[model samples]
Target: MAEPRLGQMNASFGEGSVVLRWWEWGPADGLPVVCVHGLTRNGRDFDVLARDLAARGRRVLCVDVPGRGVSGWLPRPELYAVPVYAQCLAPLVAALGRHDWVGTSMGGLIGMAMAALPHATMRRFVVNDIGPFVPAAAIGRIQAYMAGAPTEFADAAALEAYLRRVHAPFGALSDAEWAHLARHSARVAPDGRTVLHYDPAIGGPMMAGDPADIELWPLWEAASARPTLVLRGEASDLLLPETAVRMAARVRVETIPGCGHAPALMEASQVALVADFLS
Candidate 1:
């Protein structure tokens, strides 16, 4: 069978007029499902899951959040906050009429904020490997890595190796999957060196924040009132077992085994879990 036709579009948001680029799949008239990627990752992270959903007759829209992928970087790095992303995405969600949301990490936080809105058009939500409460340790870990990240790599092999080390928490991805990730996660610099696709300046606002736990319980409480599913990596340092237990009281929580911080959702089982939920 032929692969689903992939298309792209751009939307300008915020006073800075940052351009947000997104990928689309499946028939235009199909049920809409929006997939948002994690911090430092682009919409291409959802290619596997999106293709499956598209084949199932669902319209899948995967976003390249500002500063990542083909999306334009923020005029000010401070605009990298979740609230800013939520604000930028609100119009797109509203335009979809009614839709389902699937977000990973920072994307999940953005979804929470959007879902909490007074008249949110989101029908169902799937939050992947992140919660309202983010521990300071996790924040520190991310900051340390970002601070130490190499600006460029000698070749694709070097970049892929780096990605494997940092994103090993994304569960057991196959060789081809890792290659796919590397291909989308990086670009060739003018100097002919491979570099990460996201803007390095994004780390400025991220590190400027206090080195304390991030609390977004209010957003969680409001968003959880709607139908929500939380996917937690069994060994995630970010989403502790206790936290997932607490979240279970308000929404369904599924623990994906063998992963640390997040599940890639590229596996057949992982894709099925999400597809079944949205259905």
Candidate 2:
């Protein structure tokens, strides 16, 4: 019933090194479940889901992808692409030996890439509110917002309000849940104004690339070998319903009603869906 323990693992990427900060819960030798957060989010986002799974005797590991949260920002910001993210996961996955994966948004994309690899170790794959074929509209929205996000907030209260307004698509999160999210997503700046936890330059790649040029159908097809599950928001502009249907032709698809863009997976019901899938 205690909160998850915190730790960091190092992953080498060429000459530069990246440290993946993670939160661990449950027994040390329990079944491993790696939970990855979305873009602009940190490992703390999985606190609720990790707690639920850990309570059930699963060793849940939630990671803050490089460039986000407490993880060090990559010196070469160009390495912030999906391929690099997938590469970074290689060592962690190998270390786990055998594990299941639950990823949200950008994290889900990373899972898809990992699944496409020749030596995928994931026993069950759950992609939360994302698919290989993301609509350009969704990418545009993300690009526009991240490209010019305000770095300073008057105070923690102001930051929380801003997060609630921008991330309303995460569905109806309680005030406490929102507060937890804001606390993790923000930190005190050198000038003392609260700012988002991630490096602002992390948005550069997205802003520079055209969504039309990004394709992942081959990766999706490559993932057909696994028992994959796709969680889509009913009103999501990111993962189209058609794409979900196509994915369902080879895997399982679950639509979270009244949700759009993404589901935070913080609620008990949402956590239950993942628990059942991975169980």
Among these predictions, the greatest lDDT belongs to 1
Candidate 1 whole-model C-alpha lDDT, 0 to 1: 0.87
List ranges where model 2 is wrong by over 4 Å.
none
Q: What is the C-alpha lDDT of each candidate?
A: 0.87, 0.86
Residues 1-279 of candidate 2: C-alpha lDDT, one tens digit per residue: 777788788888776688878888999999899999888888999999998898889999898889898887888767888888887778988999889999999989889888888978889999998887877888888987786678788888888988898899999999999999998888887878789999887765777867553468888888767787889999998899988998899899999987887898987788999999899
Using TM-score, give the best candidate's number: 2
Candidate 2 weakest lDDT stretch, 10 residues? 206-215
Per-residue error for 268 in candidate 2, Å, reads 2.0
* Residue 50 local lDDT, model 1: 90
TM-score of each: 0.95, 0.96
- Which stretches of candidate 1 lie above 4 Å from their native place? 1-13
